[model samples]
Target: MEKKEAFLQQLSKENQKAQYHVMNLMESFRAINSTLELDEVLKKIMHFALNIVETAEAGYIQMYDESLNKLIIKTYVGFNENISHFKVNIGESITGKVFEDGCFRLITTRKEIYDSMSDLSKENFDFIDKAHHNNQKIKSILSVPVSFGAKRIGVMTFHCFDIEDGLSETDLLLLQSFASQAAIALHNAQLYTEVHKSLDEVTHLSQRLKETNALLEKRTYIHNHLTELSVQKKGLKAIIIEMNKLMDRNLVYADYLEGNYVPQHIKHFAKSLDDIFFLFTSKTKPAYVSICDTVQIDCYIYPIRSGSVLLGCLAVEGSSPLSQLDKLIIEQGAPILSLEIMKLRSQTEIMYKKTYETYHHFLKIKNPQQAEITAKELGIHHHYFLQTALIELDGNVDLHSLENDALLLLKHLKEKITLENSLLFSYNNKITLFSSARDAVSEAYITKIIESSIKWWNERFSVVARAGISTGHYYPGQAEENHLKAEKALLHLKKQKKKGILHYRDIGISRLFLQHPPEEINSFLRETFSLLWTGQEKKDDLLHTLFTYVQNNRSMTSTAKELHIHANTLYHRIKKIEDILDMDFSHFEDYLKVQLAVYLYKTFFGSLTKAGKLM
Candidate 1:
């Protein structure tokens, strides 16, 4: 009778426990279905699933992140572990195993949880110990995958720290029941989230399309406006003015051809024009630069480049930022402006080419009257003095750019020094400049003027040239004669291993020496030193001493160094030559003879070799 009574009592207690769990399960279903909010649904699912095991202290739900391809902890309750950012790969941890196979797992022993942690660098079993409720040991965890049909969503887990035996199979079954309902709520909430995102994106794209169409219309208007300006044949300044009007700002068209501002002749108030000019010369990229410290305005500098040539720039001044349309206008107008610049350069080059051909024809004329008449036809005054130059370009100068260099140089010389009618041209790597002066200008004066202009050119441009200037002649007919003299002078200068401006008349008496026969040169040398050679010294040594003395301008120290002799010896030799020749050293006539004799000796017989050792 006693055994039966004990069995009946135990059965009643078990029935009451079943009724309590059933009541909680029904409440959980109602709560999970109440909201489509994924967070609230996850929270309610975790809350009711933990209720199925009263000993389970804390738990967390981990959602599978498709982007990260990992199970990331999304929500947690009843735990001090801020493991919201915790992540696990599929088939990695207990929760990962549940997510992979869509099954329920119960982790009871601490070693079971620690054994699942994988890493060569560390034993991550401490991580679970620290991450659990109150940083206490995890006695057990019941993990079950929450899935919507065949697609697994997340891992639903319940933690039990106080119970040593932890959760059983019955506990796993209750968690599965909770996850089944939770998956439906999560699926509905995910669809709701995705729909809202798609709506926002659509709105954003619509607004962007509207803005893009407006920008396109602005660009079209700019294109037509620039084309009309081009067709109207208005100058490049017209484009600048139109842009300034369109943008409502002060802008300048940096006319590279004219090399200055050409925007309707309006004087710029901003002082950074020079600064903008510096930037344009150095950099080719379009940019905004704070051009001036005093003005505190950012200048918009747009470089116009054709290949590697920086033609110029469109510089706009103001502190305000330019609109997209303003930038587009500059971008569209830069190419048109570049074409205009190229057109202007082409026209100028054509004009120069015609002038070059005509000048070439003028140079070829032999008749004095015909050449003078030709000079007049080419705009040179018939009565004006003619200054001619024959320049040999240096080897380093690029041959392709010689014509361009000549164009600039001749233009400068003509404007600065020549009368209204001057003809100049470059051909065959030699620059010939023949310009008529208004009056009879001295060749020395003409040379000075050319030197000044060349100095200016050298400072600003890459020009390596050696030029020789002929004596100015009043007749334009003497052009051919003067060209020969300039060429002779240039040849003499080049033979001297030198570079610079040389005057034809300054080539000295070497011309006289070269024209004379060797017999006459030797005769003059013997006549000049005959009386001194009658003495004890050898003729060549005496000649060497006298030549070195005269070559050093009679300086005893310099003469000794040139002859490699003592100063006292050179002085005694010079005195002996002066005494023996009966020649007065003070007379210009005697000094003249000695200077000419040195020239004659060098020209006919070359330098006389030393026949005796130095004293």
Candidate 2:
């Protein structure tokens, strides 16, 4: 009867325990469902798991962190020490193994736990050591897979300090049910977190897009405004000023000039900012440069170019660095500036050509009515005394290169002379500048201009130029005569192998001799040098040596030096010439006659030969 009473008491205790477990599970469901927050739900799940499993002294919930590719302890309860810092790989420790196998792990003794962990790597062993140091000794353990559907999320582990019959079968089953509910709750919480994060990202992206659209609108407005400014054809200065106003900044522009027109404002600015323009023009493209030391301003320099031709440079100066929009404006403005520059250059060239034509007509036309009309069109008075300068290049320079050099020289001369009465033009491969003088221009002053021009040309193009100046002032109608006089003087100077400048008055008797008829002059040359004028191989040598010897005042040594020949060769040639002519060289009359014939031959016959009329 006592055994039957004891059995009834044991059955009543079991019933009471079952009822408590049912109540605890119901409470756990309500607690886990209370919030969708992942951390809170995980913590509640871990709390309920530790409470329902009475043998467990501590418990932890680990979640798979996709980014870390590891199972990290998300929440834990019941331990006197913290093991929240622990992490597990997918298939590494007991928890990892349970997660990997998607099943439950039961270790009934300390030896079983040690055996299970013995094969683990040093990192896992360190984790166990840390737990041991925390006084959370693990004598028994039960790790169950926390999964949703077929996807294993992580592992839920419970630890005990004392070894006992591992969890009972009913307890294991209840823990698995708890794990399923935890898994569902944690999965829902994770979905809610991801959706919320996605919504926040979408909101942030929308704000950025709006800002981008507004910026684009601003750029478009600026671009359209610049386009409108470009179409007005208000000139470069006006366009640049408008651009500066639009940017609300001061911009200093300077051009390299290069025989092109430069506005007066640009010239003044260039003078003020000479050092900056020099440094900026040296660059081959658009760039940002620091001119703080030179001009005390930060500026951006953009080269105004037209396909390898650097038209000029546009410099924008300010106290602050240029923004990307400012840079874009300059970039867009460069081509427009280039087009305007090219247009202005074309107009200037056209005006120059028209002026040249008028001057040419005034010199060539003999009709008084036509001459007066052209002179008026040329903006020149008939009474102005004009002096002409004829510039000729001496080399095998091409026509195009010569024209370019002449244009540059003319520009420099105009700048230096700065006379309103001067007109410069390129005509027949020569640069001619006609200067008006109330009285005769001093020979010294004209000489100075010629010498300075020669030096300038040599420094620029590494070439020599000879200029012929008419000696005296003349009426505008006598321009042709003065032009002819200058041409004769130039021809005389060239025959004399003179350089720099030559005046009509300096040619002496050659001026009168050059005016003689070409036929009479050729006849005189042939008659005087009958023997030497023959087209023989040695005739040229004999005549050349004779001329050189006479030119050196009959000094054989000086003649040899000038001709770059030995004195003995010159002596032999002189003797041979005397023999050929059958004349006495020591006679003064004979030598004087030969010298006069040599001068005439070069002055007249040489001119005809150059014109391809005489052999």
Candidate 3:
């Protein structure tokens, strides 16, 4: 009786020990697997297995890389560097034997007998032959398949130095089970690595695309501005030519003032405004315009008053109505051209402004120092101001207009705030205004002014404006930080259904959570709601009532008022929520589920109302 009791106790103890080891193994795996680095995790796993099993001399692990289409030697211990690079195909080595058989293979310690008998490569055989001849103690080894589900990912090999040491079949089976868990962990680690790499690449690509878009938008704006200037000049040239003909004073019909319209009196009016207009247009005919066949013989015309005109135009098919834009061009040109001609000065200011705009727009840069220097050289002093402003427009917002606003603010503020240096630029879809201030009080005042300016601009443009401002930059890098904070603040206000300006430090977490992220929350609710609704029939009415209640802010009184029923009746309808979900309303978990279901129903199924209600 005593012997039988002792055996029973021994069996129970072994079972308990096995369970404890399994749990420990699981815990260790979970702890190490939190790292996304695949190679480091695998090496640690192999080292753990080696320590736990207490293998002698050496341990090696091999993994199959699908990308390289090769079996790679990943981790090795107790091996010389010279032998570490050894490799073999899937069907080639003694290691390959277990992979093919899907079981463990054990080699006994009969060195002399096996050296001449083992089916190993000549190089490997020679090494074993030398060891055996030298009477070294490499006695036994084991190789086993590491698998998950049905797929074998790799093989684990261990060697023992003592002559009589070889693992039993039971030992091999236990190792195989551990190997399976290792396969799963390694697979997960690799997947995580790939996901993070893809995300990094995507982020890099998005930044590049944004930069390219900004450059393109800037160029378009410059092009439009240049076109407008040319049209204005053309209109003035026409008006001056007409006025000169009426005055008829020693009419020197300058070809530069009227392109390709040389009159028979060309020699007489060679030095006239008409000649100058023709020369300018002939010299700088825009790249877009192509000279189609001439429609008429040219006639010389001279300007009575003039400015720096871009091109000259003569009447082609008279008595036709001018386009609205053409009329606008002519109206703006008359006064400017007349002033320039009378003042006898080149319109260099306009030219300088156009060039500056083109250069900056063509090059959308984070650092505007180069542009600012060039502008200063051309007599346009730029100031820096730090502001975070949101631009709301049609889906196709005019990026060029936004950039122009930035430039105007920079120029205006530079003149207004002379004591402090200020700059304005755009980044990440927001206008950033950076500046230096004498004190915090001045900075706060500047922020208020900027907020008001943004609101005024938005109203003029018919769009919503949200802005945030930083205290003038404390330092260089601090400006960017302030800009980022301001952007975050704007985002916070947008989330909380608050419009206008917000300071970053003032945004609260509750406001952030309230922002309806219909995408993620809706998906979560849909999944949970579907799971709950799977085994129900009359629960649709309960779902509808719950959604309506939550939409009305979970007020039973309001729900009853809307439903034309007693508050108790509304309470009873909510009570039915627990019965349908097979959960008690008293439990926090059930209440959370009910709330989630209501949100999901509204977010996902609310749109079906357009097709005439959920029912």
Highest TM-score: give the candidate number: 1
* Candidate 3 ranges with C-alpha deviation above 4 Å: 1-36, 110-137, 215-615
lDDT, candidate 3, equals: 0.53
Candidate 3's error at 504, in angstroms? Answer: 92
lDDT of 2 by residue, 1-615 (tens): 999999999999999999999999989988998899988888789889988888887778888989998888787776433466577777886888888889798877877787887667787566556764456567878889988999998888887876666566676888998888888898899999999999999999999999778767867776677667668767877777666766644565566555232333432344445454445433566666554444444556677765544556776654367776676567666777788877876776677787777787789977767766666666555554667788887656556445545655676677766455566766434777776655545435655776698776765444457788785655446678888888987777665555677888778877877656668876776776688866665686677677777768899889899878898988888889898888778998888778887677655545323111334
Worst 10 residues of 1 by lDDT: 118-127
| Model 2 regions more than 4 Å off | 1-20, 43-62, 65-89, 108-140, 158-172, 201-209, 237-615
Ranking by TM-score: 1, 2, 3
Writing each residue's lDDT as its tens digit, candidate 1 over 389-495 gives 77665545455445445544665666666444555655645667666666654545667877787666555554456788876656655677777777777776565
Q: If both were scored by TM-score, which would come out higher, candidate 1 or candidate 2?
A: 1
- Give per-model TM-scores: 0.67, 0.49, 0.32
Candidate 3, 189-308: lDDT as tens digits: 878988989999999999989977875664455445444645566453444454344332322223322223423343322333333443433243311122223332233221323322
Choose 2 or 3, whichever is better by lDDT. 2
